[model samples]
Target: MEERVPVPPPHPAQDVTEHVGYRLKRAAAALRGAMDRALREHDLTVPQYSCLELLDEQPGLSNAALARGTFVTRQSANVVLRGLEDAGLIVRAAHAEHGRALPVHLTPAGRQRLHAARGAVYAIETRMIEAVPAERLPALLADLDTMAAALDA
Candidate 1:
């Protein structure tokens, strides 16, 4: 069995900006800003792009499932879906086939839009990842997962 390295105890930060949470939030905001700018050319907000991406990958996902995947509230997901439907990018069944879940699927137009937007989104990720050493990426991803799991616990 591989031995686990013991994690060090938390240390006090000299300032709020030095805190891990603050740094994470700062990074998230930066990423969001970049995505917002890139996605605007495709006429998509970050949440709309997120929902479309999820729907493309998993057709017939319910609103609640989409909300969870997109990290938005169910109410917000409904609004997003309504907008997509209005734009003819997606379609929801007129009535739920099972329970109260109205399954959402991307239209042909949605698929096209997602494909167009994916390039811009991926380019932003490439730029961000390039800033980090290639060899350290695996560890960085693992550390992020660990931090999220710790808070969720």
Candidate 2:
């Protein structure tokens, strides 16, 4: 038998390092890290904090609405709500008209925690964006809006 020759794989022609999806993923991961660090002081996970923020903003949001806003499943929302309730951070009351539905409200303690966490979040965000020039933020936000609109469309 003739000796076999080793063949190398062909290299791709275009640079794939800066693909849109990869950039988006990297940015999302970085943002998530900042948020996680900011919320850690309050003993809140990202999901828990997100749920609390939603409840704080909308006093009587239904579990379904909370889940929708937080991009979590109904079951996951229920779990988080239960934890918040156990922590004395939220109260769940039966809906006035919808017998099958439960409305979530932030307790006073929850409000205080959320207020404190908000400050931390703002500080974290400020630090995260400080490296960028102030003039670039409006454009960056606008680009994000444009991307969102395109995705929605």
Cα lDDT tens digits, model 1, 47-139, are: 999999999889999999999999999999999999999999999999999899989999999999999999999999999999999999999
Relative to the unseen true structure, what is the C-alpha lDDT of residue 96 in candidate 2, on a scale of 0 to 100? 54
Give the best candidate by lDDT: 1
| Model 2 segments more than 4 A misplaced | 1-14
Q: Model 1: runs farther than 4 Å from truth?
A: 1-9
Q: Estimate each model's TM-score.
A: 0.92, 0.80
Model 2 TM-score, 2 decimals: 0.80
lDDT per residue, candidate 2, 4-93, as tens digits?
A: 995643443344555666678887898889889878888887788888888877888888898989889999988988888999999988
**Residue 15: error of model 1 in Å?**
0.7
